[model samples]
Target: MTSRRPLPPPLELPKPGFGRRTPPALFQPIMGLFGLGLGWRAAAGAFGVTPAIGDLILGATSILFLYTFAAYLAKPLRRPATFMEDLRVLPGRAGLSAASLCLMLFAVVLAPYASGLATGLTLLAFAVHVGLVVAITLAILRGPEEGRVVTPVFHLSYVGFIIGGLAANALGYPEIARWLLWSMLLPAGLIWGASARQLLTRVPPAPLRPLLAIHLAPASLFTMVAAGAGLQAPAYAFSALAAAILIALVVSARWLVTAGFSPLWGAFTFPLAAFASALVTLSQGQGAMSGIGGIALVAATLVVPWVAYRVFKLWPGGKLAAKTNAAEA
Candidate 1:
């Protein structure tokens, strides 16, 4: 047998609510309120229930609130002491977290312009989105340090949003608007997947792979539909492929869920399955069930915000104050 070196001692995580005077629970309701507000605004927009002015104000305000809170999170994480502690807990996790923050900011500022004409905003947004894509791809290839899981999983959202933007362009949709879709929808699902995967992995006989697929399936559905529509392939063929993939994922996911995984993860999977089925129906030049498909599409759209709300309530920012010390230690 070859000689092996001993590993370094485990790193110390900062105490929960490390520098905060207010209890960590105070942040819970705030995150929930922000989630609810954003969801309400988004739902109103989708159902065409809100006035243009109301929609604009609500959208801008929700973005502003999320931006502000994200900024607040940055302040603490950026500090030398806290930053160092973060580096210790997950080794390379802090760096990737920092990168994720940057990518999130870039997606916000640059995505609008990127999907449109190469106007200044579009150019800026394109640059930012590309930057995010590059950063995330690198992070994945580099791999994470011990006990660090969620960060990589969260970063996958960036990939989904980027893929969405690409699909928007390929499919001849309101291209610029697709960028916004990528910015919002993709990240929420990916982040949830990452967090849930981390939690699930801690159980005996780690169920990491399938738990992850539960989150990945939705975006993949969106991707396959976009591909089917956008590709030069005959419509029937494209639809058939997408349908097959969707069926496979759903079958596998059912087994995984039955094996004792959280249903929350299935939230991401099933909607994608629905969306994929809709795309298959649409592809055959068949509009027989278009109305039903449209309704299912709308419901699938709601999954993200609902998942966002539940996730925030469950483990916003991946913190659980009650067991924080034990878990982190």
Candidate 2:
């Protein structure tokens, strides 16, 4: 019998350029800090703290990354040959690009409405948002196709961004804001629900499966915000939307135990959940005092440290098997 030849092992590739390679730990902290900044901003705004520092920090960090990411997209102008050809390469990441656009657009509209430092920051934030959105969308449209499974998760990121903006606005224009909130929430809720179901049923591989699993936290947080916002928007529209967001958060929090957190991934949830809490709470108020979201403000503030501790435990390079197919795929 002829001897069989062995196939080559899979190639391990770096993301592309020196700029893409920030030390994972450092990046995690930076991302987490931004998340914390966002959460604090939500709490302060909900409680009627003027000169909203949390809002400023959140806007600043957001604008910085938005601009930086946007700059990355422009590289193709120099190296036309390096352009991405497949959108599926990173899957859910593309969804995030789409979500960022939603944020940038909202910021664009919000800038004109907000006062003080927020005005200038909001304008810059909008520009950055626009740039990042365009770049990521183009990247996904051009990137490879295999990793597209994660695409839904990326879209979910928009849910978090929008929720933050909504909380900041705090029923700014009850009818218009409510419409915008529901517009994004309905599709997001359906898509996330369906996606989570599929992932669970299929029993996807590690890394990704777990990554997708933790996504529920952020998803739940977004739903909470949506429901809270809806209830505030108009009592008539409250029942359905409120139920959806509330149910999702409750069910997902339970799932969080088995799935656990990933510092890298879990970082997304803290601020999001906090913002949701603040919004929902703030919505509970009536008339002038509506700014004070009460108990929700307190609970949401606690979530930051709680999520932070859990996140540190699950961060990459700890006991968990960091090298699952998802990170590579």
Candidate 3:
């Protein structure tokens, strides 16, 4: 008997719209670049570095955010279902949460120039973020049993309330920020414990190893919050913890990127920026970890742009959009 050729694979057609094509994962790099700017500003405040350096980075970052946000905002207008659908995935859940955090940070950025607008964005961010967390929780429980497994990005969803606290603190609402930060610690601790158990049991796939970097972000952010609260003892403890985490991650760097570049590289951005900024904050110009912080600041400054370029390139070619397959006529 003659052997017949196997049927061909389906031809894929991508979803429409450049905005719809852009994945939420891209937001992580935006947040990272913004964090880098803030890191420099922290250095300037603590030491004698130029505030202009940070201001320049921040101004550029704002422009980038407007462009990215405008593009992403178009997704919902083009296809609301597609927008909602994205929230079901790991990158979508984490990236959009990062975006909400981005909005909160933007509120602080806009505060000096337009207090009213700043307040409005902060409220909008809070509502959007909390709603996202609820929706994600429900989605995981309802279906897509695949998403139920805990992973490093869970840190972004659960521990990121620190950014809201940071924004509140910046807007002269320290009491509210204090409440938010203190409350955040419980969830952050829970996620860390759960994630550690999962990670220890199975090494994440190569593409996902980069997300392991997210483990460092919460501690770094809490250090800043504790320092702001004048809880020096706690701040020092958190700072030490962040340092150890960073060292461990650095040692594992070879394996983390063994899968090569992916949108997940965005996971590497904010934690380093936060840790660097935290080090600068704790230094208080005393020349403690400021040198190491500067090194991290430089690393982040270089890394964010590279990741942004890689992710944005995906949008231009429609590589980011979902594709549909149909039988050939």
Candidate 4:
């Protein structure tokens, strides 16, 4: 009998060009936070508080935005089909929502300096975000629960809607903004209540534990938006609630850390940034709160860069993608 040759290893196919090697949408909040950091610092300078730092951050923000926007442009070109496929999934869909909000927030942050251009961009961003919110909401309501899991990312959909409204206010569309703002309360309330119940009742899998940080988002965002809209009592209430949630999360830091590094860790960045932004906004003229805002700003300043570094380091090598795939498996 002739000896049979061992079968050659299965041929490995090259990755498709259109889809993200990692998730493109994951970069949304990172870029947004960078914009916010610079925007806040610039605002401080415009107010005569830290001209040098503001100038430095503004320069950095411009450079960073060019880099990120270039990368954003490349995603669809690389894998148009894969990009579309991602949007069909829950987390991927949420990422799209976050992307629109990122644009909205970035525009809002820059509106003071670039009033005309920023206002136009903000309106465009708001329209896109609201459209996505409605589409995603309807899809979720109508679609069967096949692969859907109630993770914190789902909150991004409604969060984008709320942020859009806030951005509209910043762009001087007060009536439209007020309507969007009031519309948010019922949906936001329902989402927060449901998410809280889910988290308390069931422990999220290891891959998703990092999403616990998202619990801080709604409260923090509401605080900022309420303060911006002159709703002082609601702003204070949300601020207190945000602080409580933040404290609880900090207390459980060990558990979250044990989940290890995944792209999901990016979830931690924007919420903290939002909380810091809220504090800064609320502290505008209050002496005692200004110190707290300063401290929060410093923390956000450090945290965002570190997280961005970690994400980039992992992303280029496919390390985060591998971990995420394994966790999902």
lDDT (0 to 1) per candidate: 0.39, 0.43, 0.78, 0.66
lDDT by residue for model 3 (125-207), tens: 88887887787777678767677887777777767777877777676777777787789888888888887898779778887
Off by over 4 Å in 1: 1-77, 80-239, 258-292, 298-303, 315-329
Worst 10 residues of 4 by lDDT: 320-329
lDDT of 4 by residue, 90-133 (tens): 55675566677767766765766787988788778778877776
Winner by lDDT: 3
Q: Answer with 1 or 3, whichever has the higher lDDT.
A: 3
Q: Please say which candidate is ahead in TM-score: 1 or 3.
A: 3
Report the alpha-carbon TM-score of model 2 versus the true structure: 0.51
Q: Pick the candidate with the highest TM-score.
A: 3
CA displacement after TM-score superposition, residue 172 of candidate 4 (Å): 2.9
lDDT per residue for candidate 1 within 207-284, as digits (tens), equals: 333433434333433444344344434334434544454466457655545544322242352334334333533433
| Each candidate's clash count | 2, 14, 0, 5
Worst 10 residues of 2 by lDDT: 320-329
- Rank the models by lDDT, top first: 3, 4, 2, 1
- The better-scoring model by lDDT among 2 and 3 is 3
Regions more than 4 Å wrong, model 4: 1-22, 28-32, 35-39, 42-48, 51-70, 77-79, 88-91, 134-146, 285-287, 320-329
Q: Residue 135 deviation, candidate 1, in Å?
A: 4.6
Off by over 4 Å in 3: 1-18, 322-329
The list of candidate 2 runs beyond 4 A from truth reads 1-35, 45-87, 91-151, 157-175, 210-267, 270-276, 279-329
